[model samples]
Target: MSTTRHELLTAFDLLLAPERFKDYGPNGLQVEGRTTIRKIVSGVTASRALIEAAIHADADAIFVHHGLFWRGQDGRVTGWMRQRLGLLLGDDVNLFAYHLPLDAHPELGNNAQLGLQLGLVAHAGSAGRFGEQEIGFLGAPEDGATFTSGKKLAAHVERVLKRPVTLIEGQRPIKNVAWCTGGAQGYFEAAIAAGADAFITGEISEPQAHYARETGVSFLACGHHATERYGAPAVAAHVAAQLGLAHEFIDIDNPA
Candidate 1:
């Protein structure tokens, strides 16, 4: 039994619901290749580097959080775009990307998976919720586990990122935390309102520095790509087990 690219892509779109949300980049398949997909690979971004990794791994399909053709990028497929897309097309590797849909998927979301990995309790959100406070999540570390200071938590993130995490307000402590994956500095207010003692995100902006100081919310800027790889890879593993497809998750180091 073999899985056609169409069948697998249909299942992914149905599962991730890429059409329902607005995203920065193209959400579904950016390149078409062979009809049959035997090996599936996932990564955080569809960079030329990642594409090379997929090709080296002999993957038939690559699913990612960041895809080509960003909303802000010029529509023309010139320069580096041509080279990158050409690599995928030439190699017969299909690319499937899901951005916001992957971030907000409740159980399979990056934020949720982070909480689970860190052993956070109070898993489910409050029974009744409203408005803007809905997107990010709230959770507490294990009760007996020593509460980590902001510096220590940043160190943990640094270890995960394999580089120093940007630690804002080095003096603060992180007891209750909330975070959203990707470039979501705009959601700082929502995290604060969720009673988060600390907030973690993929990237930070200039004004976010002022906002963090004024709001008295501890903020940590972990690498955006590092924080988002978990959910998509986890989902890929589940897909492999359920459908009996060969799958692997190759992590490409990203600085931003």
Candidate 2:
């Protein structure tokens, strides 16, 4: 049994609690299509490639972490933006997106999911106030894995995310960690204040490297797309299972 577009939106609103976040873009139903959804496609970003792939897959809707119409971007629908919106409209496919909510969700969030994948236990208490939203997560090595070196942790992240990870190593062993997926390098300072031995994020800036070196807190830039790839798929799978609709996660490669 397929679910209506409204039903899907309500489900996600309840699950991710979009109103709780002040995100860059809208969190649900960016583009409207058919009233009922039968097939859903999930991706990290709602790029032209991903949109085309979803069209090929005969998807009724496309769910993404990075949706169009960011905070500072021009509101005009021209050029590439127009092309992308046109494709979805022409194909009659809906677009759904969740940004900060996907990262902050306790159970299926990007940060939480990444921590579990890397054999770390989520510890909300570890990290203090971070930004307008507590999207980042703090974690510690799982029981029995008392210690993890910076090199080993980076290697494990690289292996799991299937991408090369850059590390700014610290002197101490990595006993506790803080992470937030996708271009969240600025959170490194918060991680240090939280007493995290290491901080992991999708991308890093010039200042972050200098901060890591001086602060003695290890930092990892683990590929923005790679780190955020899990959350949308997880959300789509859950939505599909809940609504009894078919789901597919289409991966479009982006090194950044």
Deviation (Å) of 83 in candidate 2: 1.2
Candidate 1 stretches with Cα past 4 Å from truth are: 121-123, 126-133, 144-148, 170-173
Worst 10 residues of 1 by lDDT: 127-136
Candidate 1 yields a Cα-based lDDT of 0.75
TM-score of each: 0.88, 0.95
Best prediction by lDDT:
2
lDDT for model 2, please.
0.86
Question: Considering every candidate listed, which one attains the maximal TM-score?
Answer: 2
- Tens-place lDDT per residue, model 1, 147-231, is 4577777776676657677867634466677777678788877777767777788888887777678876678888688778788
lDDT of each: 0.75, 0.86
Tens-place lDDT digits, model 2, residues 71-154: 888889999999999999998999999999998877787877777787777764625335447777777778746445778888
